[model samples]
Target: MNLRRLKYFVKIVDLGSLTQASEILHIAQPALSQQLMILESEFRHQLLVRTKRGVTPTEAGNTLYRHAQIILRQLEQARSDMDKSSDTLAGKVSVGLAPGTAASALSLPLLKTVRARHPGILLYLNESFGTTLSELIINGRMDMAVLYGDHASRGLSFQLLLTEELFLVTPRGMPMPDGPVALATLQNVDLMLPRPYNYLRKYIDDALAIARVQPRVVAEIESAATLAAAIHEGIGATILPDSAARIIAASGDGVQRRIVAPMIEAPLSLCVSDHLPLSEPAVAVYQILLELIADLALGSQPPEAACAAGARPQCPEQLP
Candidate 1:
C-alpha cells in the first residue's frame, strides 16, 4: 500500500471534504481524488460516500482510518527515535496514570527521576480514567500506562505490578467492625461508588455478586474530592484501594477498614501496546518507574508512608 495515499485518505476523512483536504495538503483536487480512487481500488471497497455537503467514511473507510492513524504514529515514532543524539537519550515520552488507583502516586517520582537522570527527555503525564488511558495506548497516542486490571485487551500487553487490597471507608465515627468489614456487612450500608464501568467498581461488583451481597448504592461519583465531601456529609460510605482509603482516613473525612470474608483486591498492571515497541526515552522512564516501585516498596505500604520512608520528595498533588 502507498503510504502517501493512506495519508491523503486520512486527511480527507478528517476534513470531511476532498477539496478541503487537497487545499490543506497542497495537492490539486483532481490529484487528491485520484489518490483516493487508488486507495479504494487497492482495498476493493468504496471507502467513502459522497454527500451533498461533504464526504462520510463508509464502514470500510472507518476501519482503514483507525489503522492508518496507528501506522502513521508508529512511523513518526521511528523517525524520532532515529533522530535522537547518540550521546544523550532525549525525546518525548507519554505515560498515563489511571485515577483512584495506587499507580497514580508514582507520577511525581517518575517525573522527578526522569528529570534528574535523563534531563534531556521530556515527560508527559496523563492522569485519566483507566479505560480512556488503555484506549490511548492501543491507538498509539500513549507509550504506556500504569492502571488497574490485568484483563486481556486486544493489541495490549500487561505486566502485573502489584495488587491493592480494597477497604471499606465510612464517615468518621461511624460504627464499623474493628478488624475487617465483610461484604455482607455492607448489605444495608448506603454506598457511594464510581460508575459500573470503572475498573474499581467492576472489581467490587464482581466480588459482591460472587458473595450474593447487594449494597444499596446511593450515588455514582467519579471525583475523589466529591466522594470525600459526600462521605463527610454522611451521604454514604465507599470502597477504595488501601493507598487512597488511607489518605482519606488520614484527612479525617473517613475511617477505613479492610474488606474481608471475600477480600477484594484490585490488580495493578503496566499496560503497553503489544504491537508498538517502546522508544528509547520511554524505555528509560519505564526502568526508572520499576526501580522506584522496588525502592519505595509501594506494594506493602501506603504511598505517603512509602514516600516518607524512602526519603523521596512528596508528590506535588494527589492524582484524582
Candidate 2:
C-alpha cells in the first residue's frame, strides 16, 4: 500500500467529508476521490459509506484506519529519531495526568525537569479525565497518561506506579471524628461525589455497600475548581485520594480525614499505547516522570503521614 494514499484515506475518514479532506490536504476534490477509489480497489472492499451528511467508515475502513494511525505515528517517530542528534533530544511530548489524583502533584515537577534536562523538547501536559486520556493515548494522540482503571484494559501497556488511599474531605466548621473516619459514619453526611461511572466513585460505592452504609449524595461534580468551590462553600463533603485531598487541605477550606473501617483507594497506573512506540522526546519525559514519582514516595506513604505532604487541588472532574 502507498503510504501517501493511506495518509489521505485516514484524513478523509477522520473528517468524514471528502471535500473537507481535500481542502485540508491541498488536493483537488476529483484527485482525492480518485485516490480513494484506488485505495478501495487495492483493498477490494468498499471502505466508506457516503451519504449527504458525510462519510462513515465501513468495517474494513475502520480496521484500516486503526492500522494507518499506528503506521503514521510510528513513521513520525522514526523521522524524529533520525533527525535528533546524539547529544540533544528535541520534539513534542504530550503527557496526560488524571485530575483529582496523586499524579496531579507531579505536573509542575515534570514540566520543570523536562525543561531543565531536555531544553529542546516541548512538553504538553493535559490534566483531564481518565477515560478521555485513555482514548487519546490509545489513538496515538497522546504519548502517555497516569490514571486509574483496570490493568487488564486492552490496547494499552500499564505500569503500577502507586495506589493512594481515599480520604474524606470536609469543609471548615463541619465537625468530624478526630482521626480515621469509618464508612458507616458518612451515611448521614451530605456528599459531593463524581458520577456513578467514575472509577473513584465506584470504589466509594463498593465500599459503602460493603459497610452497609447508604450515603446522601447532594451533587455530582466533575470539575476541580467547581468541586473545590462547592467544598469551600460548605455544599457537601467529598472523598478523594490523599494527594487530591491535600489540595483542599492546603487551602484551609477543607480538612482531610482518612477513610477507615473499609478504606477506599484508587490505583494510579502509568499508561502508554501497546501498539505505538514512544518517540525520543516522549521516552525522555517518561523516564523523568518515573524518577519523579519514585522521589515522591507515593505508594509507600504511611497512614499517619498521609496528609503531611502538600499539593495543589486539581481534583479530577471525570475519571472514566
Best by TM-score: 2
Query: Model 2 RMSD to the real structure?
Result: 5.6
Number of the top lDDT candidate? 2
Clashing pairs in 2: 99-316, 100-315, 100-316, 222-317
Quote the positional error of residue 128 for candidate 1 in Å: 1.6
- Candidate 1 lDDT by residue in tens digits, 16-73: 9988998999999999989999999999999999999899999999889888988987
Candidate 1 lands at a TM-score of 0.80
Pairs that clash in candidate 1: none
Q: Where in model 1 is the C-alpha error above 4 Å? A: 1-42, 48-57, 250-252, 298-320
Candidate 2 per-residue C-alpha lDDT over 147-239 given as tens digits, one digit per residue, 9 for 90 to 100: 876574788887776677888999987988699998999989999988897778888899999999999999998887888888888888999
Off by more than 4 A, model 2? 51-53, 173-178, 249-252, 298-320
